[model samples]
Target chain A: MKPILPFLLFALLLGFSCSRQVQRIETDTTIDLSGRWNDTDARLTAAELVTEIMGRPWLERHVSKTGKEPVVIVGMVENKSHEHIEAEVFTKELEKAFIQSGRVRLVQGGEKREQIRRERADQQNNASQSTMKQWGLEMGADYMLQGSINSIMDAYNRKKVIYYQIDMILTDMETNEVVWIGDKKIKKFVKN
Target chain B: MKSYLFTLVFALVFCGFAMAQSSDQNPRAQQAYEAYAEKADNSHAASLGATVDKTYEAHDPILIKEQRREDRREFRRQLRLERARRPIIQNNPFGYYPYW
Candidate 1:
């Protein structure tokens, strides 16, 4: 009976464990902000929102007049969140969306842009007549796109609440006035 | 015996969680988590941006390690500055003598 005691106990434990399934219930008190926040996704979403608001009007009023895609530069995107988020990733998505819409034009911002323009000009100045005629193209951006990221968080040990806000604005370069503004927010609750 | 085993497992899990909570409460741990979260967020943005351009690449551990070393040094430097922000003591009853 003494020897059987241990075996009986072990069997009982196995049976008890088998009888119950572990249930993972997310509490209202907890916030989960863990996931893949791919740049492409952020950009694409931002672009869609922009297009929905400004694409049609901009196209009808200005884009149609040019008969060519109007070139625009994506400008500075600031991160004001606790997380060091790169605003450009989402900007890229917006860039692609505008391009795909075929309603407007897009150009690189900053030093990258200056380098491209300079290289083109240099090629034009230095190249043989045939090459210069073949490849010298000068394009100017008509507008600038800019945005900021901000976040709010409240939590105690084992539970948290987090909210993120991304705001973007498009301005006419010639006028220096904001033409379109877009905002998106993501909120999450996680419990540990 | 079964209940005893269960209690032991429960205790271990509870203790592990308690330790984690305590560590997270520590100022150093909070700073580390914030730093990591910031980096993670930026990396996400970078990865997302690169992916949009179809230019995303896998992280290089060697580069990451080198960067981390620099980050650690910067973190320590920042900690010193933060510590200095607090009021300094000129003299105290516990001290042997006052400052010059």
Candidate 2:
């Protein structure tokens, strides 16, 4: 009877876990289930970097030289970290921060740029002449923002220390000059 | 003849002032807005503006390391300046643990 009771309790717990209980939470909630990279890290890093990037002399220099708010486009952000991190999520956050600051102009790039071209092509065929979007009239991005995510892990016994470094750079599209460089470091200690 | 010369000088001064005012008014914002309104043709677009390239290229690590090292140095200097912004307290007869 005792053995049977233990088995029944185990089965009940397994069933309860199998039946997922999901509760809606606020978007701003910092829920770190694992010590791995998360949305909060991406968001906070982006927000902090935006302030630094905007405050840097490159922004003022660009304005002074060009007499315009430099048009920036989010480029490739390669994830070279230990875990599988979605680079798009971080890139989107960076783009969002730039746009929200209202300091620099933002433009679409990558797959989205292709999608826009496809739409323009379609419009040429279907839409009226007046309403159809023109070709080759797109805003040329002045600066390309690219970076890499790298990590160094130190593990001893059952404890692990993970350090992630996210480096972001802004380069002149025409000159290939790295105008601005910013980095964010996140270190977490996990013990088992 | 004197009145005519005076009128010419006045015209030149007014013209210079107008030019300075026009230059002060940055046209960048208006130019971008007008680009939309004008709907510029793509006929010569191929000859204009640099294209965004290098879909994926690694950054120079050495240069970045140097930049980071410089940044750390700058940050330390900033911290020192910030600390100095507040006057340091010295040991007094009425206070303890104030020596620095």
Winner by TM-score: 2
Q: Against the true structure, what is model 2's DockQ? A: 0.02
* lDDT by residue (tens digit), candidate 1, A102-137: 767776656565566677779787988776643434
lDDT of 2 by residue, B1-100 (tens): 9999999999999999999968865569688769876886643323222222223222434445679999999988877886677565565567543324
Candidate 2 per-residue C-alpha lDDT over A1-192 given as tens digits, one digit per residue, 9 for 90 to 100: 678998999999999989978899987789877667788887778777877787899988998998999999876666676577665666666677778888899987665666688889999999998999988788999998888778887766556677888888999997799999998888888776
Worst 10 residues of 1 chain A by lDDT: A27-36
Which pairs in model 2 have colliding backbones?
A: none
Clashing residue pairs for model 1: A30-A189, A30-A190, A31-A189, A31-A190, A32-A189, A32-A190, A39-B48, A40-B48, A84-B38
Residue A132 of candidate 1: its Cα lDDT? 65
Error of 2 at A176 (Å): 1.4
| Fnat of candidate 2 | 0.00
lDDT of each: 0.64, 0.76
Best by DockQ: 1
